[model samples]
Target: MGVIPFLLTYDIIIKFIEKSSIGINYLLIMSGGIILSLFLKGYLYFQGLNASHEAAFDTLMGMRIKFVEKMRKAPLGEINAKGVGSYKKNLIDDIDSVETLLAHMIPEGIPFVIVPILIYTMIFVTDWRLGLLSLGSIPFGFIPMMFMMKNGTKKMPMYYKSAEDMNNTIIEYINGMEVIKIFGRTTDSYKRYKDSVEGYRDFTLDWFRESWTYMAMYTAVLPCTILLLLPVELNVYLNGTLELSKFIFSLMLSMSAGVPLTRMLDFAPTVIQLTYKIDQLEKTFEGVQLKEGNESIAIKKHTIEFKNVTFAYEEEDVIKDVSFKLRQNTLTAIVGESGSGKSTLAKLLVHFWDIQKGEITLDGKNINKFSVTDLMNEISYVSQDNFLFNTSIMENIKIGNPKATEEEIKEAAKLAQCHDFIVEMEEGYNTIVGDSGDKLSGGQKQRITIARAILKNSPIIIMDEATAFTDPENEDKIQAALSKLIVGKTVLVIAHRLSTIVDADNIIVMDNGELIAQGTHKELLEKNHKYKTLWESHMKSMDWGIQVEEEEYA
Candidate 1:
């Protein structure tokens, strides 16, 4: 399309110079050729762009799915350590940035690069001297581009780090808004959020400031092919060494080459930024993952055993040489101070992370031998931090067993002591839970999660402070439901309220990272000093609460 115009112009100039009358048929043919070339160019460009966008969207979906699968396989501790903001950036922002590379650069940039070379080839064939002169401004343009790329590469890490920091700060600020307001720390928290945003803004501006001069220089110089070609080509034509027609053709071809060359250079910054984004994604895709197996073996019993298991999040061991057996159809309770690794034990049982030493087995088979899905299918874990998706109450409960009927869901909710309250709501079972079940109270959310667990009816149930938020009146109801739920199942309960687990078949007492004692609650109270002390303290706190109530009544 570009060459056709230059060829037609050469023909017209020659005809005019010769003082010959141009025929109507010749003019019509040239006009038709120009129109045909333009239509073809536009049609091809549209098709290429359409194909590229489809490919780009497909690639985006595949990448996001792969990322989610990787997250599922990776250790939960590692995922949490990366923070919600980092994952948000990687999953949404960073991955979305690849669209430009796939949808624009690959399809359009290739043609832009190729067409310029072809245009230059035509000019060189016309007159080699003129072609050489046409490339004179290229070296100057390239000098600035090289500097820009080098500077961008050097600053890319810092820029990405600031962006991640800002994302994290913003998310943290929003999530902690309740705590901030409650504690009257809103001003301080806002300052930190403000500082993070300002830091990102300042760093971005500084980076742009450093590159703007080079950007201006290259963008101005790269397309000005006439800078050298016009003067030198004219002199050569005057000297009669170059034909007038060839001189004009060469000049037109050189000018045409500039459009494609400039278009190619326009993606240079995106290419650099894309490299950094891909590297960030690769770090996660290539990170260490929990080992899993493909076997699906039948278990005669749901007995879980941890044999001298030692594990660490980073360096310091959190669970040290801990060995315990949870027999089938028994309620086992783990009791400890805040950092005594009680919650960690429950997490390990579900294979949230592989232990560094020893083995965790289900019915004498190592847990790792079962596929992740199979392993998860056998256990129902309910933690103090109950998380529900932003969906209808029915859907949230249905997650435990997607095949469950509406009647089964309501039954489970009744067993969880949540049915009455749920049905009282305007939307009944279909009530939207809002974000993370924020529309419900802490106790209500906990009951909903319990309902989910009950609906699952897995062979093994692990409840870590599951009843921590329930009021005294509802606590008894939930305990009764829990008794029914745990019947004929393996249960592990982590309790801060010592009275709740007094009837547990076996109670494991932990201090620091080691299992200090394990026995029935009665045996532990008599034989273990730690257990006796914890019980005494719990009793004293209960009495203190009663005494305060009595005084208020007086």
Candidate 2:
């Protein structure tokens, strides 16, 4: 309607110039209506965008919450296998991409597409021939889009894979920067990081170079609805089959149709990105299906029995036909050479990965029959890689028992031999540990984790080389802490240092994933050949140290 009045205003001006029209009322009214329409259009567009953003953010919040919940329920082994970089990307970057789909594509693209169809229909109703001519170029436009889709389909998977690889490399580079610097491996460390970045760059460039031709073709053809229609309309008017006013209106309407079509075409890449991201999110959700127990069993005792347990990580068995029993209120130490499955045994008892052949029983009941929550509550696990959060020292220790009082936290810290260091700090327990406890020394961090375990005070405590990083001076303190924490509790300790577990109630020797012998340290030293050799080696290594002498300098 506005187009007709505006076009007619042009004709009316010509008539007034010829002295065939005297008043300018029609021109003034048409100008006012166009101005009013422009204001209304701006208002509606902003309103729509605002509403879409609100919906998009709400949807994003829900998705993030569900994703976190899914991760919590998933097995730790499954999560580790997927890698932290992949998980972070899906949780943060992939979910952010969905916001683009909901906020812009669904709300704005709909109007951009639907309004054009309606506008073209109006043009066609006014003159059927012009309408047909206007849409004649769309088939050619689709030819380019089809090629783009084909090329995009082939490259998108590779694109996302390269991106994930780069993300992983970046995380590793940052986290291991200190190690790289200390080992003088700056070149090698940066090489891997550089390779991943270059790989992603090359992939992106190759994809764009291959698809640019098809993209240009579509861009050129999709928004030119008047290209073929204009000449045909002019020919019809010359033949006296169409009036000038109808011809002008048809031309304007064709241009309007092209505007929306062009806007709709711009959304094609967003659609592809959204579809691929959705697939990635679904894959993440499907990756970890944790096998949960039906009920939480009542555990009366802390004895653990592994009955002919056979287990594998990647088709190769790490623990083969392993049978062992740990009695309640006893300390059992597992000592073995490297790659001898010492840590694996401790992990199995904690149900980190289920065994392939037999069940592990706790208090004569299959551990699998107990709920994961109950199982975790019954055991306290401390490993060599003791992770500490970036928070106050007091808060980090309190994570073991969230309901623990401040006094209890201090007591646990004191028992772990970390109270002296904690109090020496400027803020004492309130000092932030920085990222992953980087602000603290290795021994300090280890002691804090021990404090956490002490605070947990579970009936069963499994220690996998928990004191491996501590200096000889702090070893005594840590041992004292362990003695207090494990009183009357079933303890399974994986030890690399033979001297630390020499007095263990029962020392189990492992070789090649098989338990070779089980006895006290003295009995093993006399009866087991492997145990004697390992002990000799450990003693020699402990005694070996560098000495600086003035005689040598002279």
Candidate 3:
């Protein structure tokens, strides 16, 4: 296709120079060749582009799936430490950037690069001197591009860091919008968001500013193959050393090489960006992961034991040498002040993080011996976050048990005390929960998550401040429902409100990460100073409202 146009031009020039009649058949044949080349070029390009896109999409899907699988195997603490924004950028933006490399660079760029090389070869065959001149401009063109690439490489780290930082800040700003508004910190939050955005913009502009000069030089010089070729070729023709036909053919071919060469050069930055994106993805893929075993042993009991378990998010252990036993079908409560490792202990049992030392076992088998799926199937965890998907309330509940019937879902929702309010909503079970259940109140979302857990009906249940958001009236109702739901189940409750877990079969009092006392609530209150003090605090807090009302009336 590229050679045909140049051939046609050269033939016409020769016919004119010869001062002879141009044969109609010769013209027809050349014109037909030109048209056929164009049709084939378009057809092949379309087919190649479609194939590349299909391949790119498949690769993208596979990459994302693998990334998700890696994250699933990774420790929850590691994932949380990186922040949602970082993963979002890696998963969506960074991975998506590869499409340009796979789809455009591989399919279109190869042809562009090959066509230029082929044209240069043809020119070399015609006249070695013209080919040599055509090659002269390439070195000069590449010098600036080399400088541009060097500048891009030097600045790539800063550019990517800023992009990731901006993503993190934007996500934080959006997610914390409610808190910002409630606390009247809108200006501060907005300033941080604006600063991150500006930081990214500044780094991007600085990089482009540094590269643009080199870019202009290359963009101007690369396509001007005639810059050297035309002058030298014209001189040769004028000196009668080169025939007009050969001269015309070489010059036109040199000119035709420009487009493909320029197109090929355009992918240079994309290649660099692709390398950086892959590096970022590899960081996640190589992150620390929770180990799992291939064992599928059936457990006769749901008893969980954490024996001399030590763990940490970083250097210092948050759960230091913690040992406890949770017998099957018993309700155990973990209570402590903030950062006392109450929730951490429960999370350890859930295998959110692997223990640094000792063992966590189910039915006397090491928890690590059980596959993640097998371990998760035996326990239902309702975290403090009460995270719900942006879907129908019914669908969110059904996530606990995908095959759950509608009646079972409704029954679970009723048990969680969410059924009445769900029915009152316009769409009832079909209502979209909105992003992270923003459509529902804090308590409503909590109830929905509890409903999910209830539907799961796993032998083991971990409730980390599950009812923290429920009002006093609803708390009692939810507690009653929970009491029924926990029958013959190993239930572990982490609570701030002492009154809620008063009836727990065993209460584990923690102070600073150590389990200081473990007994029935009454026995712990009687024997442990920490438990007595915690009970005192709870009693005082519970009386504050009544005291305030009496003082107001007086």
Candidate 4:
């Protein structure tokens, strides 16, 4: 509609000058048509824009939901391997980048395309010779655009990779800032952060440099549809092959034709980017997803058995031919040196990653036979990480059992030995934890997580260094709480501190991903040289101290 007035406005001015008898009525009708065309053009464009935005927002919401679901269904090991930073980019940044393409390309680009076709047809119909002259610059203009697209395609993956690396590095730097400050290693850490920033900057500049020359050429040449027509049409008029009015009409149509083509070409890069983002998102879902039964199974008992389980994160096995069983209503402790696969064993039991060879069973049923939700419902896990969300203390605990009552939450917190401190705070249970529970001390966070597990009251509990952050004064209280929680429940404890697990019913010692010893703590200390060595080292580390007061007196 706008295109009609645009082309007519040119024709009307030329016609009025050629025929002065075209009176005030004709001029009034022309003005009214122009006004109507502008009104219709604005109205229709906005209507399409409103529809496009609604569709785009719906699509965005669905896409984000699907991505989150995929992440949940993905194997935990794979998620950890990809790192959190890349997922953040994919889920938030990459998904957001598609909005503009969806919102503008369909509504706006279509009109830009249709209007150009109509304008070009009008030019050709008016005078075929002038129409051909108007399009003479197209092939030349496309040359630079093609080169630009080619360069962009070749360099885009590398550019995204650099960006992903920078995101990962910056996330790590921010997360580890406290540790860096504590160790007085700010310079070295800041050097890594600076390097990532500078590297991203350099990659962006280099990517831009690759296409800038072509971009310049295309921008200068692509919109000049009438550049060739003007000179050639003038020559034709001089030769008496073209009329003045016809030449002017053709020129007007040609100018309008170039504008839409320019707009269309501008959208080309956005199309490429949209495709790339979709491809990247698809790649994120390509890895092994956690397979589970559609039907949820009833867990008859809390017994867990590993039947010659062999597993590996990569090539080398993290757990080789490992076999163990936790009987119902038993407390089992797994003790080992650092990097001895103790953590891996606990994670494997939870089906964090499927074993390379062998089977793990829960209640005499293959673990894989149970739905993910059903399996999660049967076990409570508190890892050393102790990650907490930015929410109220009560809400954080309630996450263990979403339907749990307020009294149940407070009871769990009291059992975990953090209720007193929580009550002492200004907001009590309503106090909002900062990001990852940064507002709380390490001991406080660990206790809160433990309280969550206690609140859940699952039949099986796996605690991977759950007491790591507890100070000496609070260790006994935590142990007392854990004692009550583990009663009548199968429990697996992975601990570095020998004293904490000495009273466990059965002790399993692993070395180099293989279970080397299994016995009572007393039996291991008497018969197992490896466990004895670890126990001795632990005792010395615990007992080591200086006689500072005596030295000062001397």
How many pairs in model 1 have backbone atoms within 3 A of each other, for residues 3 or more apart or on separate chains, i.e. clashes?
0
Which candidate gets the maximum TM-score versus the true structure?
1
- lDDT of model 4 at position 255: 74
Write model 2 residue lDDT over 13-53, tens digit each, in one string.
Answer: 55555667555686677577777766666787788789999
* Clashing pairs for predicted structure model 3, backbone only: none
lDDT of each: 0.91, 0.85, 0.89, 0.89
Candidate 3 residue runs with Cα over 4 Å from true position: 19-21, 546-554
Clashes by residue pair, model 2: none
- Please tell me which model should have the higher TM-score, number 2 or number 3: 3
Deviation in angstroms for 475 in model 3? 2.5
Summarize candidate 3's per-residue lDDT along 1-554 as a digit string, tens digits. 65677778678778878987888887898788888888887898889899999999999999999999899989998988888889999999999999998998766888888888898899899888988998877888899999899888888988888888899899999888889999999988999999999999988888888888987888888899888888888888899999888888888888888888888888888888889889989988998899889879899998888899888888988877888898999988899999999988988888889888999989999999888899999999999977989999999999999999999999999999999999999999999999989889999999999999999999999999998899988898999998888899898999999988888888998888788899998898778999999999999988786434445553
* CA deviation > 4 Å runs, candidate 4: 17-20, 242-246, 539-542, 549-554
- TM agreement with the true structure for every prediction: 0.96, 0.89, 0.95, 0.93
Worst 10 residues of 3 by lDDT: 545-554
Q: Score candidate 1 by TM-score against the native.
A: 0.96
Rank ordering of all candidates by TM-score, starting from the highest: 1, 3, 4, 2
lDDT of 4 by residue, 115-148 (tens): 8778878888988888789887788889989888
Q: How far is each candidate from the true structure, as Cα RMSD in Å? A: 2.1, 3.5, 2.2, 2.3
